[model samples]
Target chain A: MEDSLVLVDIGNTNIHIWEEGKIYDIKNPIAFGEDVFYISVNENKEKEFLKLNPSALNLKNVVNFDTSYIGLGIDRIMACKAVDDGLVVDAGSAVTIDIMQNKVHLGGVIMPGISSIKKAYATISPKLDIEFGELNLKKLPQNTQEAVTFGGIGAVVLMINSLKKDKKVYLTGGDGKFLSRYIDGVYVKDLVFRGMLKTIKEDLREGKK
Target chain B: MEDSLVLVDIGNTNIHIWEEGKIYDIKNPIAFGEDVFYISVNENKEKEFLKLNPSALNLKNVVNFDTSYIGLGIDRIMACKAVDDGLVVDAGSAVTIDIMQNKVHLGGVIMPGISSIKKAYATISPKLDIEFGELNLKKLPQNTQEAVTFGGIGAVVLMINSLKKDKKVYLTGGDGKFLSRYIDGVYVKDLVFRGMLKTIKEDLREGKK
Candidate 1:
């Protein structure tokens, strides 16, 4: 097994395996060298993927950062790698607001993403059915479609504001720019991937020893 | 038919009729006078109820307040009656943030109430299963259950802040008090009912003439 490490992040909708210089979905996975490891929310998927290569490692003993937060997701820890102290606001399929002060995880807020909020309304009150493109995402929303859109924006801004009191907010994920449109924060793409790199470094150092 | 008018506001979940000095749900509709008027989101329910009393009056032109807003909900109009300007935030099964500047409805934001937020996540992503009690609602939520609970709280507070720039905010609906816990706004229990009364007085003045 080579000193290189592989990181697989399993979420609700998709599985992401980081290899080489990019992140890939399961269908588009790029084969990496030996010393592969994975962290996931889906225990079943993790087990299934591990079946293919019994030598693959599971990430253990996280790293220098261990917070009091219970159920600390690896993705959050990845974002934590960016800055020791500051808040990480991930705006993707789900909006996660994590507060990390001096490398100690103080827990955070997790809520539905904008799409999740829109989907929730459509499912419950069918009358609330309306759609707006990304361009219309900004502006004073006039109708139900726009209102829901703007409300989705407002929902994210508020949650971040609630947790981000005087803390420098580090934003990541798909809708990070959309959120940054209002909130003052540093938008860092590929936060989870950064987290993967953080672990790979640890593994690399361990290899040398 | 008596000249004293009845106001019925039929919504997706329930129907409310304003008679005397009180607002009653469909379940406990007081024995109203023959003269009746209704505003509803449900056209089918409107037709069904209209069949019972042909002599009753269905409010046509809404009332004095006519903002240039498209798709203005009766519940919104009801809240509008309370304030000629500022913002009307109804924190019911859904959270609606309507901005009225100089008594003209500019537009608004509609989002999931606490229940809707919870329901949306529950329906779409079953893995997002978290529950928090009312007491847990007031605290800075620690767990996923609490994060979700606080997320719901933050969602409402943010939307309200988006439109309520330096303007007084009027809050109503079931979760008004819950929201007022964080947001500095007046929690009117029956804003829609107050709106009903505002129109009833107009009808009374027109009747004398």
Candidate 2:
């Protein structure tokens, strides 16, 4: 792998760039003079970035994985690829939970992310427009803010915990650290980038053959 | 408790009216000639309904419950009032889950209801604009639609069940019957009205005293 190789993960909201062991989240697509590899969920942003850096390779085209799930997002596939035997949770605009056992994908489920859940409540009623704060999961809420906050965060925590069982759980994405506080899981900020790098290295080895 | 007494539950989306054991969900507020008693979460709708029927009574003004929860929705309180001992799952635009033991309110959490959850997913991205269908909770989903449906519904089901423990669960609101299928709970469609009637009767007895 070239030292200047850049790994980009373009999502619905932001463009995440990984370069030289550093990560940066930019609002809009930016040009890169260096060799770039990307997996994008946003078609428009991908196209915009492609126009600027025409030589950039989309990792989705080169990377292959063993998964039966159809229409699964490439970002999710990449995250799962990084894990050999664990549950991978990609918590961004959407929280996706996928499991991998002995190098085989065992499907997954998707839930709204924390901010999206908060926005959903706000859309339902103006009175419910409040930020989620520190809460005690053992004690039930006694106010609207506590109720909304607990419900929004608690459900996600409980669902993940229930599905976790005895498996090793891997957490990634923007809200990964926030969820790590509640869930007993390893928070890997660069899991997706690691997956992308691994796939690129494997592809290079195949080219030599 | 008069046969002519009309009980109305004004929510964010619709106004549910119960009269003579029949219930009606109307988009616009309607005037009733007979004595009307109501509990409303929507302030504007309540004001509009009051103009249509000048003598209409707001049940929130009269009905009282023993609860430490501040800013608790009156509709949720009414549902809790109907059940002496149980976890009340009021599944509407916002699914409010409250606990009542020996006629005492024990606080609860709020999560997005079925439709709101669906809309939340849709709002996150256009690709997730599919409708939720029947899903098997035991199995992880292998498709986008199934994954979303499972996550959206499964989280709520698990949260309610976890809180329920050995307590009886009472479901009400629009999606009460739908949730009843997954949860081992009794579905009472007019739980709010039952509560309203109960409070009205109690208030009348207190007035005579």
Candidate 3:
């Protein structure tokens, strides 16, 4: 399966190019460029990608869906299309857990991202501007940060436990490894980008069906 | 019918003492002069109130509850007990709307406080600070603050309209006047505190049955 195709993953904060089995980080350009097919799950990014890559005049070959699958984010749609009966948890700007049974979309919950949750207490309450530390699974958190970390991780672990009844849970993104320590499930980082490539392959194979 | 009795209204942030049709602002104190039966909703305040007025320890007349009842706040309970059938909208720290059908309690919705909603955007995104302004009823909101204000008001209007099938809607709290302009329901700003006073009269007659 030797295919010479360039897949551009436009995400919430960053963009990546998928060539062969390697992912190359690319700067999100200010204008649309030729020889680039843009796929993004974020509406804002999709608009920006189109504005920058005016060459993306028609999305006839491009698809947009958020990770939630209610719409596509390059990361989410890719994650959904990439797995088979596996759970993909994107612990990025927002912590989203997407589960696919036989590669069909099953909804998941959206919670405050790790940093977002940490910033919540700090920004909302002046007394809670402390740095959050790693969660100790064996003991209950004593302070506010520890409590937040414990609760945040507990939420993800609970979600995984709920889905683990019949599937394997895969982790990805910045907070995935941190979460993996508390989660009792299989995890694979860097799957968000891979899922994007896989979605492109699927679209190509099915002839844009 | 003229009884020389003083009524006290305890709230989350302030206290109001009603005497001779006039309301006086009173800070919850650890000690108060004679003829004052100190009462408060805050556990800490209640302890101070008892210490300030020794009679409050043996009075068995102070009333309070936490955020668990159908209408927990003194204002909410007072408002609910005031009207026979109507919708009660409390626009305080949080905006909550509940329905009373012939004095029966129906469920309500709890949403972000009006001020909090506008503050949320700024808190989450440091660059998007906005100050609320006077609302124009005839036109749609164009800016962020206006949008949030409209949203906050719209949510209450929607709920009131949805629940006003067979009941009159009543508005209370400091923001009641502001909200009343955006809604078609009746506004009674002091309904909660009034209702609490009425309850006290009834309980005194019934001997705390």
Best by DockQ: 2
**What lDDT is reached at residue A197 by model 3?**
56
Off by over 4 Å in 3: A1-209, B1-4, B30-39, B57-71, B133-146
Taking the tens digit of each residue's C-alpha lDDT, what string does model 2 give over A1-209?
A: 58888889998888988998899999988888667899999899989999988999888887778888999899998999899999899998899999899879999999998889999999888888888888679888999888987889888888888888889889999999999998889999999999998888886447531
* CAPRI level of candidate 2: high
Best-to-worst order by TM-score is: 2, 1, 3
Candidate 1 C-alpha lDDT tens digits along B1-209: 32365778777778887666567688322344576766677777776776775555544354666566677787788787778877888887788888777767777778877787877667545556656444343355566666776676666776676568898888888788878876778988778867766766675447631
The window of 10 residues in a row where model 2 chain A has the poorest summed lDDT is A200-209
Question: Residue A118: error of model 1 in Å?
Answer: 1.2
Consecutive 10-residue window with the lowest summed lDDT within model 1 chain B: B132-141
Give residue B207's lDDT in candidate 3 (0 to 100): 58
- Scoring each candidate complex against the real one, what DockQ results? 0.59, 0.82, 0.04
Which residue runs does candidate 1 get wrong by more than 4 Å? A1-4, A27-33, A133-140, A161-168, A177-187, A203-209, B1-5, B27-32, B60-62, B124-127, B133-141, B203-209
Tens digits of per-residue lDDT for model 3, B1-209: 32445555565666766565676676765444444533355566666656656653211243322222332444555667777677777776556566566566554433334554445445443323556566553443344444434333444454455546677778877677778877777887567556656555565445563
Clashing pairs in 1: none
Runs of candidate 2 exceeding 4 Å displacement: A27-35, A206-209, B206-209
Query: What docking tier does model 1 reach?
Result: medium
